[model samples]
Target chain A: MSLDNEQVQHIALLARLRLADDELGETVEKLSRIVDFVDQLAAAPTDDVVPMAHPLNAVQRLRPDAVTEPDDRDHLQQNAAAVSDGLYLVPKVIE
Target chain B: MKGQWEVVIGLEIHTQLATVSKIFSGAATAYGAAPNTQACLVDLGYPGTLPVLNREVVRMAAMFGLAVNATIAPRSVFARKNYFYPDLPKGYQISQYELPIVAGGELFIAGDDGAQKRIGITRAHLEEDAGKSIHEGFDRQSGIDLNRAGTPLLEIVSEPDLRSAREAVAYMRKIHSIVRYLGISDGNMQEGSFRCDANVSVRPRGQEKLGTRAELKNLNSFRFVERAINFEIERQIDVLEDGGEVVQETRLYDADRDETRSMRSKEEANDYRYFPDPDLLPVEIDAAWVEELRSALPELPDAKRERFVAQYELKPDDAEILTASRALADYYEAAVSAGSGAPQAVGNWVIGDLTGALNRDGLDIAESKVAAEQLAGLVDRIADNTISGKIAKEVFDAMWAGEGSADEIIAARGLKQITDTSAIEAIVDKVIAANPGQVAEYQAGKDKLIGFFVGQVMKETQGKANPGVVNQMLKAKLAG
Candidate 1:
């Protein structure tokens, strides 16, 4: 897969990142190189191998189904950019 | 118009698991908690914090798999679905991508013609829920409540097997009943414990290729799902008939307007670049553990219904009604097990009178004022000739009003049947003497006047005369 300028801008918007007009060309070029480097695995003859999702094949460790956390809303909301009535406020999202 | 086009639908249902804590954290999962109060560092995606799986979520997923006879994957992977939204503190959601916990099951639903149809379940995967974004209160901002963040959800995806909106609703209802029976989820649509998204497409009759589909999001009720699908089907048909192609997009069902509106088009659709989550490991279930869970499973709806039919000698429709909910089935069984009345009578009272009363009072079987034993007592009275069925109904009314037991009501109101032969004989004689004209008319050829004589005798006895005794005495006296 190749990353073009238009696709890079679209991804930036989806990620809520604002890129400068002058930086788009360089960013697109760098992203395309990264994609090309990852695409090198396509040349490998591995049709018989199973796809791996994790580096270590260990199973997940499960915690008991119980409530162990306390109410720390007043403290957690302190890190938000804005808050009101125990809610984290952001610029309006229409949908 | 009926045979013009074909509608194809698939559903994605998201059921919130009934766990005390969040899926990957120890934070509380109680609904209606204050905003952000239940969110911990792991839920909020703090630096260096990692997610630990909750054991109950896997058990619930396995229970659902067993209920649907789905293939329970021995090993399942978690992937991060990348997206940017204010409600999601993490930039991505941990979900299953390549391998899900459940795969390739079938749900049996009643088709439009009342015949059983099997809908193929493509997959059910485990995922964490996003927080709520409240957009109504703020003037130019939205508020995010993270109490629901990291709550475990099983997203069940179905194949494009539904041919109409009715079938889709039936399929959704079958899933709803199964989850409720398993006691894994509350299945409360109003509180959003259960919600569904529908993918709908319409094609010309006998077309092999499916048309471009539109997805309807967050249909919380069964009625809305049906209505939304029907509207979408009509809209697609209209578009195609007008020489236009159907566009693929996500639409929102505006319940107030009773129509769906475009929420996002294909151009703005998020890529959701999915990758396996590094912090979490794959989930693996041993065969022994799966067997243990399967053996410990509760009797599901279908088996219970069959048992009711065979054991209680109930009609299939009556069995279906009784087994609609576990509480109702248990209630019926308890009443029968009280061992005071016939099973069929118990079945009728439970299905007919008791259910009617409960519905009128807007109560569930669990919330009923009439206990199973109390209902058994009422049915016993009718069986043993202590009170007639008519009087039993009166007793039921009194019992519903908290008046007391069947015996107490019958005794307190002098409502017991007049089983004494002489007492009934005297009333019969009084009716024969008082209604001499009707008696002569009855003996002369008007045999239907026997009903009038019976009514007169009943009126004299204040409806307490045993009807059979009254009829026998009235016939003997009239013949003489």
Candidate 2:
């Protein structure tokens, strides 16, 4: 499960993180420790144990299958970082 | 060639739960909110913020388990899947791992033979969605929109039972309909409301061991999901044929190019460093709560389709299409209850004329101009001969145009059935007199001219003439 130095750098680049040159060696070490821990999970006795999908075993209870959640404009607008009256504010696209 | 290879295909479908509030907070789960506007302190990943599990989300996951006839664990744990992205303010996602909400269930989908194929459900766990990263701005940095950050999602994983791309789409659709039927998700792909991830690989025929699989990421549409899997399978087969191993990795489906490209190699569990979240308690669902949810469950699609067949004598295909959506089924039933006639007649009107008009206008059953009861009333008018079927079409057109009730439309337009035999006979006699040569030909043994007389009578009465009465009167005049 352990990744080499090159693999760690590749993962960080894919994730779009700007780690410093000094941080790469430490990151590689920390990630290696984490990988070793989950490798132990592979050895657990999963042969007899059915992989658990859900916590309960039974038929599902359902609603009337009608639309319940509706959008409320004024209230929804409360969370915006920028707004003008009722509309959201974004950087102008056109001159 | 290798000894034996088996393709293993599993799917993880992410469906947005139709809840009014976020899964972990009281913030509204409305889409299209301003960037960061919907983010409460907890959703924003502010310090010391703890997540409180939304009861509705847990119940929804349980309902999904019930629908698939799966095992629901009384106790499940939420683990933090750590990752870094600009949109993910929490830097880790709280999701179910070792113990998911539901397990060991089977979803029944339509196979190529049109028979039921039970696909094994690996797990369906509850999780919160990440925020959106808006890169449309002209800058090096993308803006983050946290409106969807804490929205509730049910991640349903399926065992690799699907053998082909067709089976993959069928499985996804079955899940979509169930979530929609349970009123859990809208299952709209265009809005990113429903999304899919597929794990695909290729194997030789009659193999046991699975091949190295590639995970295709976030295919929003059903077609994209199918195409992505098919393309990846081809890619893997070609790679193996070229003496290269099919590396285990996550791939992206480029819809624009209809191809899949490597995004990143598959991450081992250590990459995420999954750990049980400290702020959240182990989700312990009580039996009583499950029972309450079960009691509130509506008639599912299967049961409803069966009932439609048994009660209405509808064909299997007819029943399936009519009950595709709960709203459409409800509308069909309402029409049936409001009228007294054969179910087939009502079904024809509903599925044929009504559905056609609705589709033409890009409307669903719920958005139809005619209410269920109102439609039934119109059918009743037709069944009782208050209006001919031909005239009923006109009435229906008027109803579609926002004209009032069936009776009101009929009265306003004077489109009543013309069953007055005496009046029709007078018109028929007049037409027989006007066409002397044809009438004489009819009496001289060309009996087919009787149809010509009926047409003339119908024209005289402006199509209000009941064709049955016109036929009878025309026959009597020709015989005498």
**Model 1 stretches astray by more than 4 angstroms:** A52-56, B238-244, B264-266, B425-462, B467-480
Residue lDDT tens for model 1, B1-480:
647798999999999999999999999998888788899988888888889999999999999999898999999989999887887888899999999999999878778888879899999999999999999979999998888989999999999999999999989988988898999999889899999999999888898999899999969999999999999999998898889999888999989989999976346556888888988888998899899999988998888988989998899888887887888999999999985649889989998889999999889889998899889999998898988887788899999899988888899999989889998998788878887798788989999999998888888877888788888888988999
Question: DockQ of candidates 1 onward, in order?
Answer: 0.77, 0.09
Q: Which digits, one per residue and each the tens of the lDDT, describe model 1 over residues A1-95?
A: 38888999998988779999999999999999999998899999999998665566567899999999888877877888999998889999875
Cα-based lDDT at residue B230, candidate 1 = 91
Worst 10 residues of 1 chain B by lDDT: B263-272
Q: What fraction of the reference interface contacts is present in each model, in order?
A: 0.89, 0.00
Ten-residue stretch with the least lDDT total in model 2 chain B: B135-144
Off by over 4 Å in 2: A1-95, B1-9, B164-166, B211-214, B223-251, B254-270, B422-462, B466-480
Interface RMSD per candidate = 1.5, 9.2
DockQ of model 2 vs. true complex: 0.09
**DockQ versus reference, model 1:** 0.77
Error (Å) of candidate 2 at residue B214 is 4.1
List TM-scores of chain B, every candidate: 0.90, 0.84
**What does the lDDT come to for candidate 2?**
0.80
